[model samples]
Target: MAQQAYMTETDNQGSGHEPRGTRIRRLMSRLANRLFAGGRDGRGIWRRGMVLTALAVLVGLIMLLHAQVPNTIGNSGSLIETFLPWLGVSVPVLLVLALVRRSATALIAVLFPAIVWLNLFGGLLGDKAGTGGDLTVATHNVNADNPDPAGTARDVAASGADVVALEELKTSAVPVYEKALASTYRYHSVQGTVGLWSKYPMTGVRAVDIQLGWTRAMRATVTTPEGQVAVYVAHMPSVRVKMEAGFTARQRDKSADALGEAIADEKLTKVVLLGDLNGTMNDRALNGVTSQMRSTQGAAGSGFGFSWPASFPMARIDQILVKGIEPESSWTLPETGSDHLPVAARVSVDTSS
Candidate 1:
């Protein structure tokens, strides 16, 4: 009877230990399964995050490209490109984060804005040695609707620019400009919406067809003390704003191409182009003129001096470009009645060469 009871106790103890071990093994296996599944689910989360990052990068790049188009067709307003160059920096930063995470799509999307930024500002990095000269010329588009043409003219004439180009000349207000500028400019000519007022002798003043009409653009021979320089004053057609047609930049681009061709055929080695281009120097559409001429303000101005809608100027549409002159200084004048403030530059004609 004592042996039987002892054997029964031993069997019970052994059976209890086996069951406990089995239960522990099953629990461990279940935990291992959950951990493995969680890892797989975490990969999906990472993929989704990568997709979102790529979408953001793509949207940023598209915005950057859209901003790059010319404003000649329709003004991009003050909000888009003028205050938006810094927006492009976001793309590369996001791309870096994506790359760190090994996201292929996000890395690919970054290339768009990268190409655009380089296209717009790359040439600016090259060496810009001025070819020295004697005469200084400046240009501006004193808005035709300017309430104070006299004040605007006075400010521009005060710059002491030997030659000044004005565009967007309103026919009714021509007398006002003529009277205010007469004291400084001894010679002047107008063709369509463009005009040239000079302290020097101006000849061969004929209108150049930019396809706007009779004379929105013109070329003149300014016989300065240094030599006869070909000066072109132009105001391409103003782009209109409409809710239906996005940007109408094609017409302006075509006009620019024509003007560029005209300029290229000129025999003179030294050329000066001045007026309200209605487009930024950074715009690739203006490459027609920008490819040949150097912007004075871009070369010597302190910053990205915005010059349109004078109340709160945000982008520089007015410009002075030179082919064979040295720019000493460039700046914008104070507000006038017109929507645009005058932009002036001091360029020395390198006659010594």
Candidate 2:
């Protein structure tokens, strides 16, 4: 009996008498051994991990340093920036590859690009709908060669937008649009190929020179129930990508500069610019205007809201920009008879503020 008791006591002492720090050290040692344990070729596993880590870091750098890319090559920097959100797709691809390889290093590396992409465009992915605003404004580039002008006009008018701006308004189809919109918009102003139709009274209507030699832009003041808001409509010269000349948008860039100067000189506090800018907001060619105004679509829309080539929209060239007004919501309307879709934004103009 004595020997049995001694043996039990000795076993208990051996199992439970170790110092807490010693036990913790032993546990950590086992974990480390397990984690570091690898296949027969340990170096190959580490090499793979290093490669994935490098790839992940590259992804993050590409997104964060995209602006450093030169625009001289067909304005490629702007083109990339316009589709910056797409870079996030690579993160998931890298993650899947990491899971397939079972590399902890690659998995850890993916966090960098994921965080970088989210930091760049996370806000844009969220739901942006808020309370409706005091005024809803819409814009469309009614293709100059539209097959059905009356149908296009009717579609736009049906939107019931308080203010509508139409660009690329051809001379032959002007009357059709006028007749179609006259009932809803009693106050209208047409300057060259651009026009503004308003539900409220309009004043200070005049053509604004965009250095385009012709009247392709106009500005007006609309006296709505909420307040007087300055409205400017423009159709920037089209840009083209040629094999020899690369991205040829010199004319559009010059026009943008002139438009910026015009807006800067305006005395009004509240302003909205609606038109086919012919360039995305990311394009440096439109930096003059983009710097001075906030894009309604970017501020409140649910998505990129590309409006060009209604059949297969690739970029959002049509824009609704505002200054001294709060955008409540923004969206793109369905395809009409025109080649381009309509874009709209609702803004709150708190005149008292």
Candidate 3:
């Protein structure tokens, strides 16, 4: 009987059976450990992915908004083109974020602003070199307060421009400019605060209403060797500075719109617009003009070509725009007595077009 009992006890131990309650507890403990491990790993991955996605979306939104703002406002001091190059930075940053997160959706979203920005400013990035027949034209803002009109006229004549357009012309300096430039240009006319001097025959010269008193803008026909071309010289209203309102950009914007409408209605095919625009090509307000006409400097110049306040030029307020002409080369000339530097261009009149 003792042997039987001992054998039975050993068999029960070797069978590996525990009380039901203990077995259930052991199984539950194992399951809880597995569940906790899985939850921890999942949470860590989710957090990392969320952080990366949020960063990408945030950067992309900022870039989009920045690209949408119109560069020019009434009296805004900053030029629009200065901020155009920053879009390039945004594109790369978004691309890097997309790669790091491995988010295909975010990568796709980045293309919207990238395309818009490039479409508007892509031409500025490429090489602007091209060949065409030579037709020299010059544009300058002579500054109403210019002290040395003779010096300014002499400098303008030195540029070898076939046509010269002057802005901010004051009555006091008119005689000096007339005397200095008289020997070079055979034809000249002053409508209001602006004037045009040309080597070729100028006729049908009349003032254009650009919202300034009298005649701040005028159009003339230049009989060149190739053909007749219409040239417009304009000096838009000066943008005022005030502490109450950030740059009063509305007036300039309205003028630009009106000017654009006028230009669009003109019967002439070949047109050249020269002046101190008080804004740059990248400014959205100037889109009224910039969208219709091609800027010679932007097409063929080597650098940013900033031409305003010549002593420390931060913006290219002075400009030469061409329509129905192929620009070959463009550059800024040495400073004269005026506050703005002269911008010159060599263009080819495409009469065939």
Backbone clash tally (model 3): 6
Alpha carbon lDDT of each predicted model: 0.73, 0.87, 0.77
* lDDT per residue (tens digit) for residues 1-353 in model 3: 87677668856645546679987998998865553323434543224345545655554454445545453453332333434445456767776776565545556666766776666657666667566655899988988888788898999989999999998889888888899999999899998889999999999899887654467788999999988889988877666556776566666767777788778877789999999888777666787788889989888976768897799887787899988888888889999888899999989985465
lDDT of 1 by residue, 155-231 (tens): 88887888888888899988899999999999999887778999999889899987665677899999887788899
Once fitted onto the true fold, the runs of candidate 1 whose alpha carbons sit more than 4 angstroms away are 1-52, 59-86, 89-133, 351-353
TM-score of each: 0.70, 0.83, 0.70
* Candidate 2 lDDT tens digits, 1-353: 87667658766543547678978999998875555446567644345567778999998998888888888888777667766677889999999887666577888899999999988778778769677689999999999999988888888888879999999999999999999999899999899999999999999999999998999999999997888899999999998878877767778889999999999998999999999999888777788899999999889988778898899987899999999999989989989988899999989987454
Q: Name the regions of candidate 2 deviating beyond 4 angstroms.
A: 1-44, 49-55, 101-103, 351-353
- The window of 10 residues in a row where model 1 has the poorest summed lDDT is 36-45
Q: Cα RMSDs of all predictions? A: 11.7, 5.7, 12.9
Superposed Cα deviation of residue 48, candidate 1 (Å): 8.9
Q: How many residue pairs clash in each candidate?
A: 7, 0, 6
Show the lowest summed lDDT stretch of 10 residues, model 2: 39-48
Best by lDDT: 2
Q: What lDDT does model 3 reach?
A: 0.77
